[model samples]
Target chain A: DVKVTQSSRYLVKRTGEKVFLECVQDMDHENMFWYRQDPGLGLRLIYFSYDVKMKEKGDIPEGYSVSREKKERFSLILESASTNQTSMYLCASTQIGTGRTEAFFGQGTRLTVV
Target chain B: AQRVTQPEKLLSVFKGAPVELKCNYSYSGSPELFWYVQYSRQRLQLLLRHISRESIKGFTADLNKGETSFHLKKPFAQEEDSAMYYCAHHPTQGGSEKLVFGKGTKLTVNP
Candidate 1:
């Protein structure tokens, strides 16, 4: 089974603290994405990486950053956490292809900024 | 800007009744659409894709470029079908391979 594993299922952090949400994919997928899901805003993309060391900003990447030092690992980083940054974060990975392919998502990390 | 819209935030229906969750997109170029479902205590998974043209779990979605929509439909709804459904669109020309998802619709199939 293709598995996407998240480091933490739940996390709580204080304001102005640095945070990192780790994600790992067993499958050798070239495309990995990080999204923050909110009640009314849905899953808004924060960042996506097509290959190792290559990252692209998404619609809502203002308060977030990503690191893909290795192929199997993708990490989302918050330089300074705030109360507004509290949300459910999802990580997904997919192969690069022309045909329609579905992404495999992790269990998700629900972060709470205090 | 490419955007996928699910107008209904919630939809409720009785079991064995027909169900349709609407999805519309606003992309200038061709789009690859998909339907993802998140069941209770489960992660989101792909239910169906437009290019496949195949039905999964008795659900099918037909992409209409003219109407700019790809609505998911099932003839008979089951209680198991109750879940959160999201409509997503991917730009064909973009190499990012990122999907833009809608706000999602919570489907409730009452017994």
Candidate 2:
């Protein structure tokens, strides 16, 4: 089974505190993604990595960053957590191919900022 | 830029009735569309994609390029089908490989 596992399902952080959300896929997918899901905004892409050490910004990459040091792992970093950053973060991984290929997602990390 | 839009924020339908979850996308070029579902307390997973034209759990979606839409449909709605549904679109190739998603619709199938 292709499984994408997150480091934490729930996280609590204070304002200005640095936070890290980790995701790993056993499927060896070459592409990984980080997205923050909001109530009415859907899932906004924060960042995505097509290869190890290669990262690019997504639609909503203003307050987020990502790392792909290993092919199976992708990490999302919040330089400084803020109240607005409190949202459901989802991590996904997929093989490179046509746009039709599907991306497998983890359970998700619900972050609460205070 | 590729974008997806799910017009309905919520949809309520009775069990055994037909269900349709609308999805519209905007892309500067040709696009690939997908439907993903998240059951209550369950992880999100892909339900179907436009290109493959496959059906899972009796749900099927036909991509209409002319309308720039890919709508998910089920002949007989099941109570279990009540969940959050999202429509996603991604580019054919290149940098980021980011999948753009719509706000999603909360589907409620009441028996």
Candidate 3:
């Protein structure tokens, strides 16, 4: 079975502290994405990496960054955690190709910033 | 700008009743559309895609170019169908790999 594992299922952080969310996929997918799932707002893309070390900003990448130093691992970083940043973060991976393919998602990390 | 829109935020229906979760997209060219579902405490997963033209778990979606919509429908909704549904779109030509998602609709199938 294809799996996308997130480091933490829940996390609490203090204001202005740095936070890191890690994700690993065993599917060997080339495209990986970070999305924030909020009530009514839906799943908003934060960042995505299509290749190793290459990243692209999504609609909501202002307070977040991503790293894809290796093929299997993608990490989301919050430079300064704030109350407004408290939300459910989801990681997903898909094969890179012209045709549309299924995206495998992680269990998600619920982050609470105070 | 390319965008996906799910007009309804919440929908409720009795078990065995028909259900439709609306999805609309704003894009210039023909884009790939998809419906994703998230059950309670479960990860987000692909329920169906427009290109496939196949039904899964009794759910189906058709892409209407004139309407610019891809609504997901099921003839009879089961209690298990209660979940969050998100509509997504991907550009077919552009090298960009971003998949844009709509605000999503939460369906409740009450027993």
TM-score of 1: 0.96
Instruction: Using TM-score as the measure, name the better of candidate 1 and candidate 2.
Output: 1
Residue runs of model 2 more than 4 Å from their true location after superposition: B94-96
Model 1: CA > 4 A from native: none
Model 1: pairs clashing at backbone N, Cα or C within 3 Å? none
- Residue by residue across B1-111, what tens digits does model 3's lDDT show? 778999999999999999999998998777789999999999999999899999999999999999999999999999999999999886577588888899999999999
Instruction: Look at candidate 2 and give me any clashing residue pairs.
Output: none
lDDT of 2 by residue, A55-106 (tens): 9898889878888889999999999999999999999888887386788999
Backbone clash count, each prediction separately? 0, 0, 0
TM-score, candidate number 3: 0.97
**Residue A97 C-alpha lDDT in model 3:** 66
Model 1 docking grade: medium
Q: Of the candidates shown, which would achieve the greatest DockQ relative to the real structure?
A: 2
Model 3 C-alpha lDDT per residue in residues A1-114, reported as the tens digit of each score:
749999999999999999999999998899999999999999999999999999999999999999999999999999999999999999998888634888889999999998
lDDT of 2 at B76: 99
